[model samples]
Target: MGFGHANAGYRRLFESDGLTFGAGFPLTGANRSSPDVDAEIRLAKHAESVGFDALWARDVPTYWPRFGDAGQTFDTWPWLTHVAANTDDVALGTSSVVLPLRHPIHVAKSAATVDRLSEGRLVLGVASGDRDPEYSAFGVDPDSRDEAFRHRFEAIRACWREEYPERESEWGSLEGDLDVVPKPTTETLPLLPTGNARQSREWIADNGDGWLFYHLPESTLESYIADWRELAGAKPFVIAVRVAFADDPTAEPEHLHLGYRAGVEWFREYFARLEGYGLDHVIVGLEDDDAERALSTFADDIVGEF
Candidate 1:
C-alpha cells in the first residue's frame, strides 16, 4: 500500500463514499477556560460507543489572552496518547498540529509513537501556525512560515518513510546513520494539510495525503470540491463546523461561528447536501451546554439518518 492508503485509521474514517462524522474534543461548553479532563474523557468514550467515526483534538500550545480560546487546554501529543489508550476503534486526529512552531523530528517521533501505540489509529493534520502571538513566542518568523511549513512537512515524511534517510534541511540533518525509532505502523502516517497551510492548491494536491479545510457555504463547497477533483482526484476532503443542536426537530437554521444552530432534521439535510458535494468527512464541534445530550441526539438522529 502507498503512504496514506496503508494507514487503518485513514481508511476507516475517509475511504468511504458517503459522509462520516467525528466529535471534536474539549467536549464541554467551556471555551476560554480549562475543561474538566475527566468529563471530557467520559464523553470521548461515549462518543465512540454511540458511533462517532473519529475523535478530533486541537493543538493550541499556548494560551493567548487576546485570542480568547484555550483549545481543550491540553498538549496535543500527550492528550492524544491519553485518548488513544482510553478509546477503542475510533480514529484519533489532530484537528491540526502547528508545524512551523515545532521541530519536525519531535512531531514525527510523537506521531509515530501515537500511531504505533494506537495500533494504527492516528491521522495527523498539519498546519502553519495561525495565532500571530504563537509564532514570536516559539521564536519562529511568521512571515517565513510558508517556507518553514514546506520544509517541516518534507522532513516529517522523510523521517517516517525512510530508514535513516540522508537529508539536510533547516529543521535538521539526518546522515543516514541513525533511524528514528517507533516508525509508523504504515509506510508513513497519513497527512492531511489544513487550509492550504500557505501553499498553492497545486502544492497541496501534490503533497498532502488529503485536505482538511474549514466549513464553507454549499455553493462554494461544491466549487472547491470540483477543483479538488481536478487536481487531486479522490484524495479525501474533511471539514470542521461548530454546531448547536436545538430541541425541536424542525427548527430552522441560524448562523453561528463557523457553523449553525439548527434542528436534527435540518442537519440531516445539510450533511446530505455536503455528501452530494463529495465531502468525505466532517468533525463537528458540539456547542450545547449539555454536551452528552447533544452528542447522543446527534448520533441517534443526525448521524444515522445520513
Candidate 2:
C-alpha cells in the first residue's frame, strides 16, 4: 500500500500539501560525551508539549571515536521506549537503524515491541551501515551490504505482516515453523529508507514506505522531489537538518554541518519553501548548547508560523 494509505506511523507525521516538524534526540549540544538523559527526556516532554509532531532517535550501536558523535548515547529500542512512555501523541522514530549490521529478527522484534507500546506510533527509518569500522567489528562482510540490506528488509516485512511466513534469502530462511510474535498494530509498520541505503532511487521508491534523506540545497531538493513524485507518487519525503537559531528574527543564514545557522524569519521562509517543494517532514537537530531555549524559540517562532 502507498504510505499515505497505510494506517501506520507515517500517517501521523505526513500530509500531502504541507510540512510537519520533529525534534531530534540527545536534545542537547553535548557532542563529545554522553548526553544528560534527564535533560533530554525533559526536553522531549517539552517538545511534545509545545507541538512538535515527532521525536527522532539515531541508532549508533558502536560508537566509533573517529565518527565523533555519540548519537543520544543509548540503544534505539530502550531509548525510544523511554521516550514513548514519557510522551503522549508525538510520533517516535529512528533517524535510522542500521539494517545490515544487525539481524532482522532482533530488529523486527524490538521494533514491533516499541510499536505496540507506542500504540502504532513507530516510523522506522532504516539504513545500510555507513560507519566502516562497524562492519568489521560486527563480523559482517562490508562488500555484501547491499544484498544484506535487501534481504533483511524483506525479512522484517514478512515478520510483521504474516504468521510464520516462509522466506528464503542469503541472510537465512524462515520455514513457516514459527512466528515472530507481537506484529505491528497494523499489518505492516512504516519503513522509510535512509539516503538510498545502497539501493537505486527506483528501488527505494518501489520498496520504502517513505524516504528519509540528508540536507540538500533548495534547487537540488526541488528537482529531487520532482523525480521522486514521478516514481513514488505520494510517498513522504523527510530530511534531517542541523540548526542554530540566532536571537534576532532577521539574522541571515550561515553554513553549519548538514544544515545552517539562521534566524526565525529565515527558517520560517525556508520551511515554507520546503513545504512548497513537496517535502513532508523536517527533523531538526538543535545545535545550540541551550537546547531548551532553542527548542522553545523554534516551536514558538518557527513551527507556530508553519
Candidate 3:
C-alpha cells in the first residue's frame, strides 16, 4: 500500500502524515522558456535553502506556440540531473512526462540515471498527454494514447524492477536478453500518474505510487479526496496550484485559473483545510513575478502550516 514512498525522493516530499509544499521550474526571476540557465540553477539552490520540499520540472516535448507555454525549455532528465548536482536534500520531480509521446525504454534509462545520480531524489510524474498537436507530431494516434499510456507505464516499471525483464508493449519489448542499465537507487522508482493519463481511476489507484491531480475548487477537491481515500488507502495525493500573492495578508480569494490570488495568511488557512481533507503535498506555480520574496513568504506562512 505504501508504494514507492519507501525511497528517499518520495519521502522527502511526503511524510507518513501531514502536508508539504513544492515549487515548479523557472523559479521566479528568469521565469520563461528562454530563461538564463545559470540564474535558474542559482534560484534552485536558493529555493531549497528557503524550504521548498520538492523542485519540479515539466515534460513538454515540443513548443506548442498556440498553447502558449514552453514549460522550462529544457529536457526533463538532463535538467533535473543538473539541478540534482546543485541542490542537497530537496526532492527532484517531473511534473508529468508525456508517456504516449516517447519510448518507455529511454524514459526508464533517463529516470534511473537521475535517480542514481541524485542518490534517490527523483519522483517521476507520468501522463498520457492532453496536447492535441503533440499527438500527430510524435506519430502517435490520439485515440490510441490511452493504451499507449498504459503500456508505456508497464514497460517503464518492468525496465526498473526486472533486469532485462522480458516484457512486450505497443512501444516495444525487452526479450530478457538486453537490460536497461543502472537501476534506480532504490529497487524501483516512485511513479505518480498525473491527471488520468487516459486510464480509469481504479487503474491509477492501483498502479501509481501516488496521484498527481490538478487544482480544483474546495468542495470538489474535498469530494475527490474522499473518493481517493476510499480507493487508495494511504497512498499520497499531490496537486499543482497556480498562485499569485496579494498585498493584503487577509485578502479574500480571487480565484485564478488553478489557484487563488490572496495573501499568505489566507493561503495558510486554505492549505490547512486541504491538509485536513487528506491532501499530502502541493506543487505551487507562482503567478507573481517576485519569486524570491513570494517563496520566502510562502515558506514562512503557507508551508509553515504543515
Candidate 4:
C-alpha cells in the first residue's frame, strides 16, 4: 500500500526533490568487445552530466577467476537495454538480478521490457546469487540460495500483479489470463532488495523497496541502519561503497582491494558517515588508476556535499 511516484519519467529520478546521486556499473568503450555501444551511451550521458541520481547495473555471471570482480563485464540484457534506451534523465538500476538463475518469468518479462522501454525507467534489483561457478553452470544449486530467494521473490511479485497470478510453490504455476506483460509503466515496479539475500529481517521489512548494504563501520553502520529503519516501515534505504580517491586531501587511509585508499577530506568524512546512516542512496565503486580521475575526484569533492 505504498510505492508512489507515478513515472513522470520515474518522477524526475526518484521524487522528493533532491539528494540521490548514483553509480556502480561504469565500464564501457574499454570493455573490449569491439561493440562499445557508444561506451554505454557515454556512461549514461556521463551520469546525466554529473548530477547523477541513478545508473547502477551488475548481474555478473562466471569469472570467479580468483574472485577478481568482473562486474559490468557486459551482457546484462543488451547492457540494460542500451542503458534504458539511451538515458535522458538517469535513474535505471539493477545492482542485482540473480533470482534463482533466471525465469522469474524471464525476470518479469525482461524487467517489464525495460520498464516499458524506459518510459517508466526500470529499478528492479533483486538478488541471491554469488557465482559459485555461475551456480554450477546453471544446474543452479549453490545450496538453494535461501530457497531460491523465496521462490524468486514470490514469483516476481506474481509476475507484476496478477492478470494471471497463482504461481504455486517451489516456483512454478501461472495459469489463466497469464497476463505478465508490460504492466509496469507505473502501478509499481521499483523492487530493490540486494543483501540479506537469505530473507528475514521481518522478511526484508516485509518485502523491500530498499535495503542493500555493504562496507560497514559507520558506528556499526548506524545501528545496522537503525534496525533497518525500524523494520523499514516506510521504505527507502540504500548504501554501497568502494571508492578510491587520492589527489591529496591529506592522503592517509590506504587499503584498496574493494574500498579505502582515501583523501578528499577522508572522502568527505566518508560521506558524512553516509549521511549519518539514513542514506537514501549512495552507490560509488570506482576502481584502479584513473577511473576518470577517481570519478572526477568524486564529482569535485563528494557530489557537492550531497
Q: Estimate every model's Cα lDDT from 0 to 1.
A: 0.89, 0.88, 0.86, 0.70
Best-matching candidate per lDDT: 1
Ten residues in sequence with the least summed lDDT for candidate 4? 27-36
Query: TM per model?
Result: 0.97, 0.96, 0.96, 0.33
Q: Kindly list the per-residue Cα lDDT of model 3 for residues 97-125, writing each as its tens digit.
A: 99999899999999999998998999999
Error of 1 at 222 (Å): 1.0
Worst 10 residues of 3 by lDDT: 26-35
Candidates 1 and 4: which is better by TM-score? Answer: 1
Judging by lDDT, tell me the better candidate of 2 and 3. 2
List ranges where model 4 is wrong by over 4 Å.
Answer: 1-21, 24-88, 97-120, 123-126, 129-142, 146-169, 183-241, 244-253, 264-297, 301-306
Residue 43 of model 4 has an lDDT of 55
Worst 10 residues of 2 by lDDT: 1-10
Query: What residue runs in model 2 are displaced by over 4 Å at the alpha carbon?
Result: 1-8
- Per-residue lDDT over 1-306 for candidate 4, one digit per residue giving the tens place of the 0 to 100 score: 136734543354445523465777754424222235565577567756777677787887655766665677775766777887777667778888888878788888888787778777677678888767787787777787788888877787777776777676655777765778877776667777787787787887887767776677668778878898788754666766777666678787787644687778987877776776666677777664445555666777777777
Runs off by more than 4 Å, candidate 1: 1-4
Q: How large an RMSD does model 3 have?
A: 1.4
* Root-mean-square deviation of Cα positions for candidate 4 versus the true structure, in angstroms: 17.9
